[model samples]
Target: MVKMLCDPVCPPPNLSQHPCCTVKCWKWDVNQITMNNLVKYGILILNRPITQNSGFIKNLWNRATIRMTVDGGTRQWDKFISGLSNEMQTTIKDPDLISGDFDSITDEILEKYKAKGCKVIHTPDQDRTDFTKAIMELNTHRKQTGLELSHIIAVAQTSGRFDQIVGNIQTLFLVKEELLLDPNTNVFLISDDSITWLLMPGDHVIYIPEETRQHKRAWCSLVPVGETCKYCTTTGLKWNLDNQSLRFGGIVSTSNTFDGSEKVTVKCSHTLMWSMRLPTIAIS
Candidate 1:
């Protein structure tokens, strides 16, 4: 049976040792993850404007073991906190690091954060996007600090330029190799209305919050990336896939809603990009 819990408890056990075991559990409720527990997650803000739920962002910032911004993301972060109340602003911590090619961030904002003792990493690689470069920095930071960050949450948006969105998704595919992170290190992209991540070829269980499962408009999708998912099966979705093929020109699961099940199960033959619509969360 799949283990499911609302609170951030212990890390999932190693089921790989059991040849018949292939289940991996996932939980996305950052708000419930407290600092009292092990700091196993990091947060990265991309250049896209953070127009998502402020309270949700606040929880992520407060609970993150490492916080960073990429290029113009510095300006975006500054703008985000500037709108918060003085009391709220005081609760948020300064970013631990700021990195980019230094093209988008203004000198004033850059200096301000530097004055706050944030590390500045100048990455001028024209081949990689700032987002990808930021992940490289994250890997370096992990080596220097010896912090075991098992998960990475990147704050970005999906409504911007289409190419930028696709580029962000492409970065997910390169995370393990470029960042030199563990194969199990999960990376997620959170936008104004959704959370997206890559699902490797395996069995997976995604625990949905009760509120989101009941939300009338909540949706989820699984799209094959890079190559077609030759064999994909799912449960707990309004339209479950039964040994179906998912490809760009073939049958793709989009705008699919939940079937009121608290958890969804997926078994796939190849890497698939999974995304779920976030419920309307109250801003603090």
Candidate 2:
């Protein structure tokens, strides 16, 4: 029987006995990690067919193998299909598959991909987000084909409405660990830019790459979501805090940075959050 790894990611029971297990890299702040070594796989999830976002699709096509469209707020199936731009029309017609509720996908586009052997699955579980649905579908397809994907390039995942952006961010929390197993998954809110996620309990080194810009300076934050905290320490930032504990009303690591490569290490029971600005359409 093939060995199957289980959820709740952890190390092998007997490290010495097993002798061959994926090394678990620990980090606190994952700021400067690169996509240097990893199997790269791509999946595109569009809320609706693209019309004017041809540049986005072209960029995604450069990385992704399978493309998926999910039904969202727009409910007009025929209109949505007919309204797609020529480029989007071509992509949808030639994608690996189309999986989503048929509420918004027009008959024209649907028939086109289906005729080309695109497997369409109509999933209408309101409780589960469409983002989750597409991911589950991708995982299933990956298993069926015996293809191992390193990362997923999720396009147009953020945007549409305020609530959706929030839901999408929450979705990051849900899929963070699952993505770590594969090459690596990038969830783009919109355009070619992306939102990367990280967790706590390890030490991390972060820095802006030379390719991004001649000089990179932006705010870095460590937000403690859901609750307050106590004690915080950081380095390589304008405002340095050591042995300093923060609470709901206390100091938070917001809008802080240093001259050259900024390095940060922290020990926190809460999730420390950070965001930095980069050049347009930066994918690394």
In lDDT terms, how accurate is model 2?
0.50
Report residue 160 deviation for candidate 1 (angstroms): 0.8
Model 2 poorest ten-residue lDDT run: 1-10
lDDT of 1 by residue, 43-102 (tens): 999988888777768877888889999999999999999998899899999999999998
Winning model by lDDT = 1
TM-score of model 1 relative to the true fold?
0.87
Q: Against the true structure, what is each candidate's TM-score?
A: 0.87, 0.64
Identify the leading candidate in terms of TM-score.
1
Candidate 2 stretches with Cα past 4 Å from truth are: 1-38, 48-59, 72-93, 157-160, 176-194, 211-220, 226-233, 240-258, 262-268, 282-284
Candidate 1 all-Cα RMSD: 4.1
Clashing pairs in 1: none
Error of 2 at 62 (Å): 3.2
